[model samples]
Target: MTDTSSAGWGLRGTAGVSFAATLEFDAVEVKLGGRVVLDHFSLTLKPGEIVCLLGESGSGKSTALRVAAGIQPVHGGAVRINGTAVSAPGLNTPPDRRGIGLMFQDFALFPHLTVLQNVLFGLRRLGREAALGQARAALRRVGLGDREEDYPHMLSGGQQQRLALARSVAPRPGVLLLDEPFSSLDARLRETVREETLAVLRETHVTSLIVTHDPEEAMVLGDRVALLRHGRIAQIGTAAEIYRQPIDLSAARFFSPLSEIESVVTNGHAPTPLGLVATPGLADGTAVTIAIRPAGGARMAILGPGTPGRIVGKRDAIGIDICEVSVEGLDLPLGLRQPSDAGLSVGQDVFVTLNREHVLVFARD
Candidate 1:
């Protein structure tokens, strides 16, 4: 076993490297099986930044990653790395030829090879001694130095993921692409491994792009998130900006569960059972839908002066109390999430207060 603490395998200085490396997709378009997968997709990743490509399945998230890796050909536009075009009209760079590393959803480690051998596989171009040294350092960097002789099956899922990451970064590629890398792990282990992986990527200072369908995962991992819809960017911004001010209803619902109420703008205000909500910049008599998040706005209390409501149902979730409250003047029961000790019960009278900040008024779709 090597002394992992003293190895300093984390990416240090660029040293001799002069220019910063970047990844760019300029008006990229792709088609597969005669169906358009991506259209006019454009994104840019500055050096050392982690950008998450987030969307539902078939939204072209993985297709964009493949294009960046040079595995998928673009029908139109270009893919560039460090100002050099890798994918364009008739020119295409092979996956291995482009200096980019990729880690698939499945760790893809060979069952027959030892951990050291797997890391060495990426560094085969170096001499025997140099490759051996790099492989050992990479293993130590991932806290798996003692397991160099172990095969893939002998390690836990988290260890295997770290091994895969070590192999990908062993070549010191300027850009790293991860396609749902933590999807295979269980929930608890996924979070731990994700943190570890992010720390390593930051230390390496490699511009990284991750593809995931989970909005929470994107919020946790991305410095900026690019939310795709129908092969196009629906919204792109920091997690705070995306969640606080979604461009539309589709973009808002992507980040959190919402309860919608229909209303018509009257004197620049929409009336709801809770109260009058401001709908500025809207013409009088304009129809609109107001969206509110239970966890963000709702509060429960014993029956009192607040909006009159009767608790029709109650459920105790993992860490919160979910109550279905039927308010006067509302046809549907509004879901409210409060503290577990809320003491709410079915058929009990209660007061529901809506936090004005959580209310979002949008034009009806």
Candidate 2:
């Protein structure tokens, strides 16, 4: 396929046309302090595709970004942009020439330089007048055009982020990398800023890779999610695919708040207090792990007929009412979150049932 990002700009009224670009990580490997940070990591982003890279700390999320940005050296493999090998064995392309833009977690604005100057920094290849025009248009794209004359310290946290985004995109990079771009903002502001950022990215149609620890944020920003585990791509899929059908036990645990039950498969079923859950493809007598997500997936009732349980406690957790239920034959109280208007409270007698949608069965190790 042709490289769509060759145009380098968009014709948005007066702005340049933004064509998308592709990014490829071919078996990339990186080690820091003799510790392997990334191992045989391979992923690709199509032109204008937005992918969210999700991983825990020390899981090579940032290292992956640095590798693509040409700031971190790889021990093996290659990083490619627009079909060109930028980082490979004995080949390292300077970041400025990589046709990519990086928006850092700290916003990384020059404290002394005006906003327009900072945006202009990346457009140096163009003539002075053209650079000014591109910088102004970029600022306007991010809603920071009026603040071009203001210093970084003079702007709010959200505005600073917008300035940084403008600076990164002013050069009309084919690939845009954002490292925890909204982590510094408060929850309310982060949502608004994230919406704005997603809009700009879609408008420009830039291939974007966002690094975030937030699952919800990843789902909101990414067209696909690439989950990393111990320097490897554990799973790569759409939000629904990853959330609904995880690759394994660890993945299921990572995506949902689960209550674990260890059971042995018997006659193609695993018996539990809820009922006989089907265990297909597992031999009889095989040990299996059953994960149940109680929040919004387990139905609890006070009047209907079901497995009887007494509500031991209840609390409002993140806009949901999670109740502790003590069922017979169980050693611990099961945490079951109820729907809004259930009006459930502690010490109430209730019936509990597992929603098959929230249940996951995995063969034990």
lDDT (Cα, tens digit) per residue for candidate 2, span 259-284: 77788999999988877789989999
In model 1, what are the clashing residue pairs, if there are any? none
TM-score: model 2 vs. ground truth: 0.92
Location of the lowest summed lDDT over 10 successive residues in candidate 2:
1-10
- Poorly placed runs, candidate 1 (over 4 Å): 1-20, 303-305
TM-score each candidate. Answer: 0.91, 0.92
State the lDDT at 239 in candidate 2.
Answer: 93
Clashes (N, CA, C under 3 Å) per candidate: 0, 8
